[model samples]
Target: MSADAFIAAGPRPPRAGAVATTATYAWRGLLKVRHVPEQLIDVTIGPILLLVMFTYVFGGAISGTTGDYLQFLLPGILVMGVLLTSVASGVILQADRAAGVVDRFRSLPSWRAAPLVGAVVADSVRYLATAAVILVTGLLLGFDAGGGLLGVLAAALLVTVFAFALSWLFTTLGLVVRGASAVQGIGMMAIFLLVFVSNVFVDPATLPAAVAAFVDVNPVSHLVTAVRTLLAGDPAGADVALALAEAAAVTAVFAPLTARLYGRP
Candidate 1:
């Protein structure tokens, strides 16, 4: 059926109808993934390459042995995978906006929040796929999760939740940016800054005292630390709390901002 027929603009839709509208838009996003499997390249290839190259190539240099490094690096790689995929939500939204897809949806009588919400929700699918690739690659590379299966799964879910929250930040950036390429560039720069400056690749204490303080405060570092702590079967303690707080703060700030900006004429 045609989009017009699928979403006939008439009376204002009931509030409850928002669920159906959001689901439809979410399905549309998923269909795009199905048709353009090329879109999966970043999520699939990036994690594998990072996991392999980092664990084998740089791992020994950084940690004195490949085996010890793999254990430490796998958790960070999982977080890296999730962080990298968070940009998908914004890039997709920007493309849709540039193509007038969002404009067309705005004309419908559906829920105002449906388009943004659905697009970000669809990105959670990408986040999950990347997380899986990282997990499997880490395992094959002899990275054992000290916390076992349950710990690994829990860590994946936590990273996905954090990624879901960060998606709103990038989605807002997409709305602010002019083009899809610019959105992707800006998103990557932000991710790069967060990851490199964090404890993802190195021990924060090994850095200068000033840089180390920032690493201690960086939300990404907190997240990686949480994953490490969980996988080690140790108490996550403050790292988990800090990571979750950061996620909540990011979502709270950006969700409203993205919704407002996207709703603007």
Candidate 2:
């Protein structure tokens, strides 16, 4: 075909098979974790420390006993744990940018966003592992799901889905900021404010009126409330709906934005 013929043919869509390309990159991401085992420590240690300190030290003051507080705190802690882990996605992307990985992806004949999609897939695995650790730790600490097997499973699924959606937000930030330390610093500040001001450690009613109002509308609060309802075997009501809506909104906004900015990173 002549160049003129090709030009006349109009711009062809970048070859489709994004699934395989995404899987390949996802595998690369997993292997990175395997080679650098220390990367796993970030997700593991923080949750454990939070669980131990909260259940042992503050449990008595907050819930009258360790057992009671563990049950009450477990769901909230799970939400916080996954949110913290979400920061890693951004950091990883920042590293990839600095290492010229993004530039290589642009030169390759793969779908423009395949590597990012693959990263997102790998992140799902990471998020699932984090959720599993949280559940097992909660169980070992004497927290039981009154909502039974089905309830716990549903809650876990919901959280993993939300985590996937949330990852896109970080991915976009990585593309925009182009610095790991900057992403980490911003992520830490945002995560801390979101995690602390919500109903994770205490009842919202106990917060001062202005703070409580912010928590009431916070997306993390909705997620924690949904998880707690599921664990307690209570009706999820609209909490699950609200949480899903929040996740969908985030993914809808960030996923495409990240894809568009992937080449720039």
Candidate 3:
């Protein structure tokens, strides 16, 4: 067809819907993983090593038995694994910005937020991978899921939701930070503080009064408790509600901020 005829071939197909655009970008993110399989290390090796080391090195002193500590520790390790993995969302975004991929994304005729939102959505796979590795390793170590398979699934869902929300917060940080390394450094530091200060490795009751007060309200603590409750076969408690609420609140605050700052130079 002549150039004129092609130009006159009527309007191009309608722009993709939000879901379609987002899914396309999400697929693009997954393609990156296929090409660079090393990206799987953080979600796989890192979490497994953490679960094993923490369980063996400190388990006996803390819980009197490796088996008992494994039960208490598995939920927290699951949360920590996924939460730490969530930092990659921002690091990847920062890397994309450096590579000019985000600029190219701006020129595409797709949902404006798709690249940003889709990055987080794609990172969900990493979150799930992290959770799976931890769960499998815990089971191998004789960590019983008192709450059964259904409870295990529920706990995974809750952790994913919390990780998704936290991804947005890190997304915002990615935009504000200048370099991928900077984002990773700052993000990991913050995550370490949050995990250590919470009830992950130790009981808040053993913490200093002021620190315990903070741990009581730390969203990480709430999330870990919710996971523990589900895995323990206990009725869903207020912590479950609090965890969801906190996740919603985080997404509400940071998603828009991420959208706002997304394409800026």
Cα displacement (angstroms), candidate 1, residue 105, comes to 0.5
Backbone Cα, N, C clashes tallied per candidate? 0, 0, 0
TM-score, predicted candidate 2 vs. hidden true structure: 0.92
Model 3 Cα lDDT, one tens digit per residue, 179-221: 9999999999999999999999998888899999999988899
lDDT of 3 at 79: 98
C-alpha lDDT score of every prediction, in listed order: 0.89, 0.89, 0.92
Candidate 1's C-alpha runs over 4 A off are 1-16
Ranking by lDDT: 3, 1, 2
**lDDT at residue 100 of model 1 (Cα atoms):** 92
Worst 10 residues of 2 by lDDT: 11-20
lDDT (10s digit) by residue, model 2, range 1-265: 9999988799776675878888999999999999998988866777788888889999999999999999889998898888888888889998988998789888998888889988888988888888888888889888889999888888888888898899899999998895899998998789889989999999999999999999999999999999999988999979899999999999999999998888653
Candidate 2, lDDT over the whole model? 0.89
What TM-score would each prediction reach against the true structure? 0.93, 0.92, 0.97
Give the per-residue Cα lDDT of candidate 2 at 95: 95
What lDDT, from 0 to 1, does candidate 1 have? 0.89
